[model samples]
Target chain A: MYLHHHPFCPHSRFVRLLLAEYGLEPELVEERVWERRPGFLALNPSGETPVIVEEMAASVPGAFIIAEYLDETRGLALGTHRLLPEDPAGRVEVRRLTQWFNEKMYVESTEPLVRERIHKRYMSREQGGGSPDATSLRMARANLRYHLKYIGWLAKARKWLAGERLSQADLAAAAHLSVADYLGDVPWDEDEHARDWYARIKSRPTFRALLTESIPGMPPSKTYADLDF
Target chain B: MYLHHHPFCPHSRFVRLLLAEYGLEPELVEERVWERRPGFLALNPSGETPVIVEEMAASVPGAFIIAEYLDETRGLALGTHRLLPEDPAGRVEVRRLTQWFNEKMYVESTEPLVRERIHKRYMSREQGGGSPDATSLRMARANLRYHLKYIGWLAKARKWLAGERLSQADLAAAAHLSVADYLGDVPWDEDEHARDWYARIKSRPTFRALLTESIPGMPPSKTYADLDF
Candidate 1:
């Protein structure tokens, strides 16, 4: 399998974490989505990263689609360890929270912050790149606090974000938060419950790759890879 | 089943269409998401419409989540008529396109147009509602044309949006576009293929409810409910 992804893209990070948890490694193809390369657009007309092509050449685009596809194809192999629960109710919660992180959180915070802080560095002026927009960044930071609070509330209420089992919800939240944390944008100390939850997930074997994968010029925060933090 | 939704909300419309297709009628609870009612927020923290509470009282929120939940729970009964195909490959396409309409199209066109043309009329000044922002409307209109062209291209190539069988993808696109059409915003003459696809889907028995659902003062366009249009 080949996965077209960007290291700093939160959605790509979410899929990468899922692939690692499933123990199915794909050859990662770094895609500069801003470039809107015709070849990449052919693979995914959306021109978004985190599109995966199976060996049979059927390409699946979007993180949510990939998550369900992988779970359906590979979940049985993992049995009880599958990231998605088998029961419909459990699956609903997993899917809801996954969407929460991927859609809501990404829109309110991650997408803006990443675009301003990370993507701009890689994009050309013609591609709408420039110095980060302070106004957008400020709004995103304010929104991030609200999301972190919600995460803290969720983390405090359950052993895992969704339930007893470590489901996709945890991975989704961790994936997005990791990207924000990498930029030193997450106010980890503001919410201990959220921080504790992050610590637990960050220590997992699957998370190691995310900690190590960094954008060359923009170094991750001092505590980004520090598990104890 | 109880579905908390707003008539003009594209996501809610998508789920409503799906429910009608499955022959399951829901007691629709109209929610003004801008009010942020605590009870509604309890059901869906995002404060978005289209949250469904099943007979068993399982509250499933978000359009995409509700779509998958309904498919998993009711799809088997539909057999060949299931909106999501049985195979993983087919399912992925259905999901990807469903998201394209729900997420991409909503962000680009439907949400902005609806807010500008519909929701703002109902929202109080304190609720951050007023005259539509011209800049946002202009951008959304341009995006809508691009999206319509895309739909036309896809329609020309496939028997249905996703494939030979009618799937969630078609429902999703039609749902969003239907709302745009309601406000007389879609340029149907510009893309005959898209217009033809819309006509076919809009003629379905399941689409009747959508045609009749109208806001208090904002009546649909002259051609909104016309099957031949």
Candidate 2:
């Protein structure tokens, strides 16, 4: 199986982290989704990455479907341990948590940062020259507190976000944090539970590729690579 | 089992239509999600409806989970005639189509209509009982055409969307069209495939209730009740 992915996309990174934890490496092909290549469009008209292709199957599909397919085909026990819940309520919580991190967190935090600092270069549109607009960065910074607070609240209430199992909630949360970590947007000092959660999640063997990610003209925070962080 | 629904909520209506088609009926209890009452939030914090309570389950769940539960527990012979597809690709398509109708189509079309027109009574912040903005209505009207056109395109190419079996796609599309039909937003004249598809979907015994719907402020189109149309 091959994954069409972009380093900056949180969803793509979410799948990558899971594959990392599961120790299943795929042929990683970077896709510039916004560029709209005809060949890529043929694979996924939605123009979104995290598209997985199984050599035996029909066509490309999105992340959730691929995760499910992986579970079914590989008989991967990773879900039960690291990415999914043992029970129904736990599973729903995990899915809801995953959606919360991927969509809500992206809207509130990542989007503004990406638009101001990353989108222009990827689209080759010179808006603000991909500079971090002060207001957007401020907003992204403020929003991160709320997300972290929420995660902290969840972590304080349970051993893990999706319950006793480490689950996809951990992976999904880590994916968002990876972007924030890359952008230096995460406020690690705000919440102990959230901070501790991130430390454990990032220390995983699968997180090595993520730590090495470097976007042009942008650098990780000094503490980003710190294992203790 | 009971359903908490709004007549035009595609998810609620889709579940209703599915129940009807499968020769079952649940008591219906309608709730306006925007009100955000504690009672409704207890059932689903998302504030969306079409929640079902089953006697067999330890607890009730939100729509998709509930529907899947029903499909499993009801002992219904939906095997070949199932709304959900069996093949992984087909299943993914059907699930995505369901999400498309419930999430994207609702976001794109239905919510604007109900929020601006039907839901104005519920949106109390408008001190003047503010008239529905013509610009948004116009945009929504145009969007509905595109949505139906896309559905028409999908219907034309496949035997049944997700293919070759009368699945929930038909029910989902029919539910959305029924709501639009009630508000006279549907443009059957714009696409032949959509027009014909609606005719066949509504002709089912399940669609009889949709035909009888009437809102005090806005009556359904003259042809709304005409099944043969």
Candidate 3:
């Protein structure tokens, strides 16, 4: 399998974590989506990242669809360790949170923050590259604080974000949060519950790969890889 | 079941059509999401519509999550008529297109058009209401044309949007298009294949409810409900 992705994209990070958790490895091909390459667009008309092409050439696009695809194909192999719950209600919560992180949180915080801080640097002048927009950065930072409070509330109320067990909800939230954390945007000190939750997930064997990933001149925050942080 | 939704919201329409197809009836509660009602926000903090509350009070939120929840809880009884294909690849296609319409198409076309041309009409001045922004309307119209051509290409290439069988992909696309058609925004004559496909799906018995629906003052376009148009 070959996975077309970008390390800085949280959606891509979500899928990578899922693949690792499922013990499946794909040849990761980093894609600069802003370039809008025709070949990549053909793979995914949306020109988004984290598209998985099977050995047989069936391509699965979008992190949400890819998560369901991976679980449908391999969840049975992992038995109880599956990221998706078996019951309908449990699955609903898992998916709702997945959508929350990928769409709601993404539009509100991650997409703007990442686009302004990370993606723009990789883009050319004609591709909308420049210094980050201060207004957008300010709005995203404020939104992130509100989101962290919500995450803290959720962590305090449940064993996992979805329910009693770890599911895609945790992975999805962690995936987006990790991206912001890498840029030193997450105010972890203000939300202890969220901080502890992140610490637990960050220490997982599956998270090691992400810790080592970095952009050439843009290093991750100092404590990004520290398990104790 | 109780569905909190707005008639013109395509995501809500997608779930409504799915419920009709599955033969489950829900008490429809029209919600103006912009009001941000405390009750509605409790059900879905995202303040979006198409949230379903089951008889036992299990709240399933979001169109995509609700689609999966409905299928999982009831699809086995559907036998060969399941909206989600049984095979992994086909299921992926069905979901990929579902997301395409709900997120990509909605963002590019439906949301902007409806918000500007329809939603703002119902909002108070304090809520950012006024004349539609001409620039947004122009952009959404152009995007709709591009999307229609893509739909036309897909319609001509396959028996259904996803495959040979009718699935949520068809329902999702038609749901969004039906809303646009209601406003006379769809250029049906420009793409014969898309028009034909819409005609086929629009004639389904499950589509009856949506066809008969109308806003208080914003009556549907002349041909919105004409099966033979």
Per-residue lDDT tens digits for candidate 3, residues A48-117, read 9989999885799999999998888998898888899998888988998898889889999999999999
What digit string (tens of lDDT, one per residue) describes model 1 on residues B29-79? 999999999999998878899899977757999888888888888889998
Off by over 4 Å in 3: none
Which residue pairs collide, candidate 1?
A: none
Model 1's number of clashes is 0
Which regions of candidate 2 are displaced past 4 Å? A75-82, A126-137, B19-24, B53-77, B126-129
lDDT of 1 by residue, A1-229 (tens): 9999998899999999999999978899999998889999999988998999988758999888999999888889998888999888999989988988898899999999999999898789999899999999999999999999988998999999998999889999999999999999999889999999999999999999889887887789988999999
Q: Give TM-scores of the second chain, every candidate.
A: 0.98, 0.90, 0.98
Count of backbone clashes for each model? 0, 5, 0
DockQ of each: 0.80, 0.34, 0.80
Worst 10 contiguous positions by lDDT, candidate 3 chain A = A49-58
Answer with 1 or 2, whichever has the higher DockQ. Answer: 1
TM-score of each: 0.96, 0.88, 0.98
Report the CA-based lDDT of candidate 3 relative to the real structure: 0.92
At residue A41, candidate 3 shows an lDDT of: 94
Q: Worst lDDT window (10 residues) for model 2 chain B?
A: B54-63
Considering every candidate listed, which one attains the maximal lDDT? 3
- Fnat measured on candidate 1: 0.92
Better of 1 and 3 by lDDT: 3
